[model samples]
Target chain A: MRSKTRRAALAVLSAGTLLLAAACGGDDSSEADESTITWWHNSNNEPGKGYYEQVAKDFEADHPGVDVQVSAMAHEDMVDKLAAAFQSGDLPDVYMERGGGELADHVEAGLVRDLSDDAADEVEKIGGSVAGWQVDDKTYALPFSLGVVGFWYNKEQFEQAGITELPITMDDLYDVIDKLKAADLTPLSVGAGDKWPAAHYWYAAALRSCPEEVLTDAVGSLDFSDDCFERAGDVVEELIETEPFNAGFLSTPAQEGATSASGLLATGKVAMEMQGHWEPGVMQGLTDDGKGLGDKTGWFPFPEVDGGEGDPAAQLGGGDAWAVPEGSPDVAVDLVRYLLSDEVQTGFAENDMGLPTNPAATGAVSDPALAQLLEVRDAAPFVQLYFDTAFGESVGGAMNDEIALMFAGKASPDDVVSATQQAADEEK
Target chain B: MTRGGWRQRLEILLFVTPALALLGVFVVWPIASAVRMSFYRWKGFGPMEDFVGLRNYDRVLGDDVFRDAVAHNVVIVVASIVVQLPLGLAIAMLLNRKIRLRGLLRTIVFVPYVMAEVIAGVIWFQLLQPRYGVVDGIISAVGLTPPEQGFLGTPELALPTLFVVLTWKYLGLAVLLFLAGLQGVPDELYEAAQLDGAGWWQTQVRVALPLLGPTIRTWLFLSMIGSLQQFDMVWVLTGGGPANATTTMATYLINQGTQRHNYGIAGAASVVLFLVSFVMALAYQLLILRRDTVTQE
Candidate 1:
């Protein structure tokens, strides 16, 4: 009996020792690869994934002994993994950063490496596009793709509705909605179920109503006291009253499958959907033949509001940037700079992956509708980052919830502003 | 101590250590950390330095959304027992009879409970979609007008619709439990009731139900707890949306924690959920379940 006890104790001790040794072994192996630079990206599908792999290989060939280990993940999976990484303080050497308040949070925690000095040339080339990834005038990430949000419409449907010209003003937009309804078509589809898609309308409205300075200052101050902010909500309210959205728009998802807002537009159940540059790609995935709206796709900016103080040409948008985590090797910055290089970005544009930020790549956009979008994006005075990204999740979430409530005819326009102010106050 | 006693002690310690260690690491540690987190203004990451005592709790309690979530949970809890008890009892009693193809009938009834929650949620989401969904088609086919925004899209109908879906998902468990309880009743009791010239209804009401008290109480406890922690179905279906009409406490906490990055608020909300569940469970065990324990002893 005593021998049995001793045997059991010996087994336990050995197991503990084995586990400790294995843990130590893992630590040693990870430390052994000093030249390894881990990169995580969300281009898990096709040409984009293959392109990134080639880019990594090219970098490796150029700089011998420096290995770039790329992990291509689906967008949401990458975001979730990055969040976990942030909490653990064990992030990949390089990863995609969505910029704005999310980047600010990472910067505040000292998790992101400052690229102001390291990638200065590339930052300079990227120019104003770097504004979203900047903190206290120091750049932390290099934006490779910066695209504006606009109304992606179906040209065939527009023609069928006898809409000869794209809507350039809020009144014109309402007229278009009326015309579409007369044609017995759902005029628009907003994914209010996801909240952010619905909130984008208000963001676009605010961009049209508020002056650029006030809008920029609000990002810094978290203030929404300006009457224009409430006016923006009023714009959304007026639009909501027009009843242009698809049936059950309040419960529709953003981009999921064929039943989503983008899906409705993709499947031609709705005439248009206000979405980012990724709309075409998203639509393609939702269709049977994967042609999406194909050649019938059209692009137009969110229309100017009546009596608004802001520039009509200023667009609402946000994009991803390449950021190196704090403590990453200097080589990681070099890799990020290379990613933003003209050659690489142009190649990115050629693939029709995104709206490349580099000027040289602007002409390389292959898709006709994307090319049109690029023209409007370049002509715009400035692209306002999505308010949700600019304000961080807490305030943005509150703002979105209130806006969603407004869509449900529960919250008033004033309530939207107050709820947002309340949340922003909490942040302060 | 005798050598045999010492060996026995070592044997017990060796066998119990892994489970206790697991319990400490996974369960006790998370609860402790969540409690600690509830006292701070943490945004899911960085240092946990901003210690705001009870502020998160205050915010959670004050938020109308959280209040609505709690109310939804309560409605689900009470409604589950109220609706499922008699319905489950009836189904169980019917299935308990020596009906033809009993095994196939039982499997069909139990199928939903056996299926994955997410898969069921996805299938139901598709079926409940507005204008074009199978549910809408069926309703329209029956010459009834479905709500313009469909069942899950309308705020007034969303919660009720969710409740119906949940009932469909969980009714099998209740029926299966009741059936098991009925099986445990002595055959002689029914025979004796027959000798007394009791009708079928009288036998079931007098002899079967009384004997099934423990199982019924146990099933009620399970249903109540399950309803309180309901998240997956609500998340997949409405995402507590159509203006936060269907928000449960679990969904609310997830929205606060993951979606909003307000870990402190999430932690506070979770602690409140834990407390509510704990108190209710304790009260039930002490006041209601104690009878069964006493009888067994």
Candidate 2:
């Protein structure tokens, strides 16, 4: 009797599960009949989000029949979700693409659409493949924006602290830090709250100083003890020793620009912050506003250190790219062109923190702050594709880990270089 | 009629068929497929797949990361069995006394367990912040640094700190379970102990403990398994950082399989994890529990 009862209950449960599966199958068929496009993105910032929403509405209005579905997610999440979706044969039609190492990995996996053959004319249209976006002759991504990470500082704070010029080398940075400490202000309002922010100190410093060949060599073998690794770790130690970072930085994780070091700079609690051009719009209408910072907000190129080979004017960031997934229908190709059209890219720039991927939108971006950033980009000897994008995820993971420790003053440059090398060996 | 008997038997068979089919599909089939996938070389999403029997297992047992993850999981289990068990039991005994607002205290004590792991990790992350965080600032104001190493960033300290947080979050449930077990022990045993002039500790050890053997066994099984499968807290607060110092076997398996898309190797790791956990649960049943049943009979 007990066994009979168990059988009856199991039958009911099985029937319920089967019914749900059948219902889902029916919905998929109806959805297939419509012109639906799914986009995977990681733009969660206020302006970035607002920009995409407007683009969706406008794209829908222009296309008439096509329906665009934006499946936006965080950067790390997109990597996992896309992998799962791709495995199940349900990949989104379009998503953001990274170049260098990530681009190579994608092409190797046969997941890239290889826009080189068809996007040839458009490739030249967006400034001849961007060096960072091209793997050999083939193109997998269309560069929409060019960016370099720099320290955004308050001019007023510098003057108040009796600082005449921006720091040029490690010693100058230390001098400014001492003056700021004497003035009873936070020297650098950085939040080690996020591991990546901590990582930037290591990678960006290395980019500032490490030779370009060493970076290329490291990428090839996934080794880290190369000279660049030592330089990166040493710079982090120098920053840590000076108490230059914000108080409670190790424990406090960064949220957004407005709430992090940038917010502190905006409020005049600190003089400067290490960040990309992504900070100004983030701080414009601060609800959690700090004191003393008025309308004058600005950015300067990161300082040139004594041993650093990096050009002071060189931008530290790479821009976003739009790419189609392999096996996407022909409409996806047309949609890509539509999204990259001169009018849309121009509108994106005007409406959002849009740096244009389109050369046609070059004159359209009239924002002075943006134009200044562009000048830096043009003068840069090399805009290092953000290291994480240049290296695979495993390399990035180890780099960020050791880098975080370096910032905390617990680990040395030699340790970082060795740890990174060990991680690379393990990845192999 | 005998014909009617056959029809009755046929009806019974029909009812049982659905359950058997479900077990085949949901339970048996998936386990079978997982084991099958373990033998192949497949990244989660890529097109390239090659059949290589025992190779995935070979890679897993060979990898240092896998060995490290297992060692970390063992640490979690030991920490729970030794620390959380005794502390939970002691708390349960104290709460059993007639005190003012005992009901309120019980509810308040269980609150951390009720909190979401992400929320708990986030709150703890803030409270432990080095500069403005009240705790760290207080520690520093006393002329001592909050340790030379960043607590969460240190390889030696990260896993143990996480275990302590885990104990706090889970001890409430352990206390409640222990309280229920305490209640199940008869009043007669304690009364007899008191009559024999036994002290409180002696009574607890001699009389109350023997009756609560079943509860202890159950708790041990649960705590061991739960700690072995731990993920969310470590994911949110530390993200198994400072060079994978805090990575548990489950986290590593999931990260490699799902996050890194190395499905075959992940499957191999999962298989080993399953075998180890299975053996542990079985040992608990046989040594800790089934033996008690036999002795009782």
Candidate 3:
């Protein structure tokens, strides 16, 4: 019996060890062929996914002895997989990049290739949108799509709430919220559980409160000593105090299904959601009929902060870009250029996938709402990338956590500032 | 003497070599490498030149969120012991008697244990959703109001709600194990107890419980270790949020290594978790299970 017990103990120990081993050693081996260009993108849905496959097939057809392998996945899954691939040294030849602090880290680690000299013509065509992808005037990636964050609202809900015009200022937006609440409707639908969705509130507030120079300087110096940052938190805190969000917004996911924040807006359960150009597609996916809000959906830029020094037209946005990894063949660069060609960009625009960075495709945005967004994008003096992507994972994650705490009513605006500053110091 | 001969020794060595090599490669080597990595400040990628020397451990211990995660794991362990095991044992004892549809009932109870943890979490997440979910709908139909923030969304209630879900998911395994243990207890022992004027409760407490010690001890260890290392369910259900309310050490390690690219800190967390599990297992063997071995011998 003693020997039997000993054997059982040993068996349990080995079983636990094997489980741990399996978890740690599950990395997939990548093919070593240099001729194949592997591409990863977040357009996993129809039209966009099909367009990408067509693009790859065309590229492969044009260039003999070359293969374009495309993997389309959801955005969040792609991020997690890309992080794992980066850690394991199994990165694809060419993949989508969101330029900011993440790109800086990749560049510093010598993982990303400098594209300024190789894809100069494509860089010139994308214009200032390429600034987000640059470090000290050298481009590491080329922006394919560019758009801004704004209110994606159901017009019928606003009409029911007795709000006739879009709010042009912060106070006016609050009044709109009050009107919606009076009508027994949820004024806003934010997915604070996701953290990034809630963090966007603070980012929009900062964009409205701070000057572009201050925001830009903070990224360079890692010094968030500016009062505008704190004021931004205060703005969000005040908005939170109004209790304008849906009943369980803190735990609601961003775009999961009919009950998510985007779904709430899509189903007309909420008045609006502060989302990006991708909101329409996400909303459509959440609806039963697939038509989403359709003509009832409207867009307005994030409301301006009254008496603030920041430009009203200065927008907060981010876009997906293509970047070549270090040691990639020249064909990777060529493929990236082809993606930015007028024909491809025009197709991208016509499909309403996003606002293409290529200037020649500017008129191809057939969606009236998107066209209005393009007008706002053009008139904006500067565009700030999403703070999380701009600051990279470490600082961005810390900032997001604190912002989420504030949304949960556990942290104050001052706490948000101190926490962010402390996190920046630690990351440095 | 013949078993210890050179030929026999060589045969044993040859038989053990493959297993030993696999253990070294997968288990022993990775543990040692993680220990070495815990001392450095390396992202998962790139070189490992920056040696921080226990700084990662210091940071992890100092972080409030990490402490909360550790606390949550402890709650799961305590809940499993105090609630899940007893309920499982009672159900097992009840089902061991002659009953109609016994096999079907056993199968129904055991079904949840076979379901994937991620799938269970997702299903529960939908069921416990605030206003639109079946739970809330049922409560409203019965003329009751669900909590405003929902169950999993609120910080105070999230961990307890998760415990309930965990109990629902795992109580079947414990019941099945105890049922097997019950079969091993000879009917003669109960007959002997009854001859000594023992009641039904006396028979259970004095006869069946003592005989089932080995199974109970094994389950205790399994449940504790499972609680400590849980990841899939909590991740899918909460992603350790509303505020880090459901974060476990495993989830925290994944968040650090995979999401934040802080491999050094993740390695440090992993080492701490391994040491905790190891120490607990050793203590259980030396202090509790040693008596069983001694008596048997």
Candidate 4:
């Protein structure tokens, strides 16, 4: 009986091993159907969510027998799931890509489909905004909504602080800070804990201090030896010395809750915060009544620095794009092109989802604050993608960490440049 | 060979095979893969073709942030034992007495341990927020000033503040273990000590304490290991921020691996962590826990 029991156990053990092997070895894409297209997006909240559902239905109706499976998730959740999918080589038919070195990496790995030929007409209509998603002149993704980062301030707080005209230069900015401080108001609140928000100060400074060519060259080379880069750090350091930030700003989160930097601006606790075009929407979410700063919401571009080599009109920004995975069916590219069409983009603008990339939809932005931002975005000589995004996560993460250290009064401006350079050197 | 002997051997093999198979698949395989990963400079998703030998290890040891993280882990391990040992012992001793509402007191002492780590972390995070937090409000209410950047936001205070939170979360375990140890002592021994006119404090120190040696030593070992591997509280409370002041090795590896995509560096850091833990646990088992096992044997 014992011998029989041992034999049975052996059979079970072999069977389990075989099952495990089968589970691990299965390829998700091997049995994929041509008629089925999977699209994952992060517009999981209202009007945006409902609008996207309608868009998917319209596409399916146009091409009968083709099934488009739509999965809308929270932004962070979608990012995490996409990362997992990338690692497993089992990506959906189409997904959002925040272009820069991340897209470049995806392209190099042969994970993204090049749309230069397939979506040529749509690409032509989108124009320069698609530059961020292109690797070596081959466009891998189609930008939908491109926007710039700038100071979003409370108009009431600005008025209360006795600021008359918007600051046009670094000295003017300093004067404004002094005036706000005199009024017992926090001049600025940055989410240094998130690191990227603190790093945005440096990115904007770099945009002002470096010549456009030098900035563009540095992106390709990952070299920060230029004097302008150090100058950018110096500008940030001078700003830090003013001590104009909110108390406990070093550990403040970005957009999580009411206590975050955007929250402080939304609730009128601070006069200003440097943030993306999504600030108004983020603020709306953080407020109880869902009308963030209401009529008090105001926007302004980053002030130019003294003796800066960059164009006074240059801005720092980035945007998300729709990218088809390399193995996706041909219809997936058609869906991406359709998504970027003027009609869909106009609807996207009407919903105030983002700053639309399609010029045809630019006039449709209903939010007055967003409309002003769209004008600034169009008027800028060029929008430099946020340096962290341009440099990719590893180097970008190190740079952000050092910048955050500087915010805590730990690292010097020189330390920031060297740390970033070291991380970039490793990437070589 | 005898048929009965063959059957007996088969019976033993039948029970052990399943367990060995599980250990090989889950534990051994993951460890081996991690060790292999340390030798490559691959991104998280790509082919592991960039073999860099010991360079990743070299970088991990050379990075100042990583070194600081190691130091933080050490500090946590030492502090958890130093701070929690006496505090837990005192509470356990007091609760062991025939005092009023002893059951209620015991339940209260052990409550924090039953709470999830993440939930407790979130609660402490809110309570310690800068100016608006309950702790800061109380400090202001009492007319004493709190730190300008909050407890978890100040570079010098983040680690110490984390230690206090950790002690609150974990002291319950130490108390529970010590109380159980106290219960095991014979009633006859206490009675004899009482007949000898021993005071309560004296009885505890001279008689009960000596017999509670194994339990105290065991608790220290557990606490040390837990503190060395601490992550969740630190992750939620401060995220090793305010200039990376409270980073532990676990956080360091996670930041490198997931946040920065430096998979090789993370793998090397993980290997170093495993070696450190292995040596510590082995030394402890041989140098300390061996006594308990030897006495039992």
lDDT of all the models against the reference? 0.91, 0.72, 0.88, 0.91
Per residue, candidate 1 scores C-alpha lDDT tens digits across B1-82 of 8998997887888877766756766688899999999999988778999999999999999999999999999999999988
| Model 4, native contacts kept | 0.59
Q: What is the lDDT of candidate 2?
A: 0.72
Write candidate 1's Cα lDDT for A222-331 as tens digits: 99999999999899999999999888888999999999999999999999999998999999999999999999999999999989999999999999999988777888
Backbone Cα, N, C clashes tallied per candidate: 0, 6, 0, 0
Instruction: Place model 3 in a CAPRI quality band.
Output: acceptable
Candidate 2 true-interface contact recovery? 0.22
Q: What is the lDDT for B245 in model 1?
A: 96
Q: Residues A233-351, candidate 2, lDDT per residue (tens digit)?
A: 77778778877766545544454434355566676667778777666665664435533244566677666766787655555687778877777765666667766888777877776
Q: lDDT of model 1 at residue A413?
A: 84
Q: Which residue pairs overlap in candidate 4's backbone?
A: none
Instruction: Give the CAPRI class of candidate 4.
Output: medium
Instruction: Please list all clashing residue pairs in model 2, or write none if there are none.
Output: A148-A316, A148-A317, A193-A252, A193-A253, A209-A308, A248-B131
TM-score of chain B of each: 0.98, 0.88, 0.96, 0.97
lDDT tens readout by residue for model 4, A1-428: 75777578879779778857874884656456889999999999999999999999999999998899999999989988988888888888989999888888888888899999999998999888888888899999999988999999999988998899999999999999999999989999999988899999999999999999998888889999998989998999999999988878888899878888999999988999999999999999999999999899999999999889999898899999999988788999999999999899999999999999999999999999999999999998898999888889999999999999999999988999999999999999
TM-score for all predictions?
0.98, 0.84, 0.93, 0.97
Query: Which of the CAPRI classes, incorrect, acceptable, medium or high, describes model 2?
Result: acceptable
Report the C-alpha displacement of residue A353, candidate 3, in angstroms.
2.2
| Model 3 stretches with alpha carbons more than 4 Å out | A1-36, A60-65, A74-77, B1-4
lDDT of 3: 0.88
Q: What is the DockQ score, from 0 to 1, of model 2?
A: 0.28
DockQ of candidate 1 (2 decimals): 0.68
Clashing pairs for predicted structure model 3, backbone only: none
User: DockQ: which is higher, 1 or 3?
Assistant: 1
